[model samples]
Target: MSLRIFEQRYTRMVKEACGSESGFVICMLNSQGNKDLNEHIYPIGTYVNVVDFNLLDDGLLGVTVEGVRCVRITNIKTEADGLRIGDCEMTAPWEFTATKELLYPMDKKLEEIFKRYPEVNSLYETTNFDDPIWVINRWLELLPVDAEKKQEFLQENDCSKIVQYLSGLVE
Candidate 1:
């Protein structure tokens, strides 16, 4: 949840989230230079709850955020401050059903990765491995994929597809 605010578009959004009661919306743009706000960006994003804010010695802002839920953004607009605002439609809480037994292998792989890296485990001490959604998000965060690629997984409503994708990555 430590996000480095490298882009101007994100700086204002993160700052505003620090003061807002509802938290912030983070939509992943397809391209870094994509200035077209009218273009349909990915609908899904993690509604982040800003827990801690710090101004690092390197002059970069380090934000500690927690994913509250998945949100679908619509009616996006670019503000004068370069921050994109939108109406967020929150997705209902999702958990893996018993039918998706294919997730078991992905779950095992995630457990193995965590056990092999205590540093990673310490970062996710509060995570519940029993939840498939949690496991998928953790894998997405840990994987070396770009933001847009991770956004692709987030947009998928089916947990099995995400688990399958992660399993494929590990395999």
Candidate 2:
């Protein structure tokens, strides 16, 4: 949920988000290329709320954001300053429910990861070990999967595919 804005061009967008009433920004990973960001971004992205921003030790902008929900982005446009804008329609949050039995080793293993990497732990103020959606989503984020795979999983109407995928990893 935290992001480091290093590029000077992108800092303006963060600052503007801070000043906005909602403090929300839609974020998607940029693919490799010299193409514009609008061309590189995936159709789905997380709309995050800017919780805090500070100057990092390395003189970059360190921003802590909270993921609000998923959105499907469309109708991309570009500004003169090279900023990409798009229409974001709120998409349903992945309706995955997890019981203690389903979460099993994955929940415990995630705690181990947090303990091993405090930097990752510090990104969020709280974590819900009981929330199946949260556990699976966090695991999904940690997986070294391709963007296409991740996007395809998110686009599903239910979590059966993801459940199978995560079960394979957790076991």
The candidate that wins on lDDT is 2
Q: 9-37 in candidate 1: lDDT tens per residue?
A: 67777766776755886666665444675
Residue lDDT tens for model 2, 2-92: 6799876578788778777465446556576236546677888888878888999999999888888888888878877877778888887
For model 2, the local distance difference test gives: 0.79
- What ranges in model 2 sit over 4 Å off? 24-26, 29-37, 97-100
Global lDDT of each candidate: 0.74, 0.79
Instruction: TM-score for candidate 2, please give it.
Output: 0.84
Q: What lDDT score goes with residue 101 in model 1?
A: 60
In model 1, where is the ten-residue run with the lowest total lDDT? Answer: 31-40
Best prediction by TM-score? 2
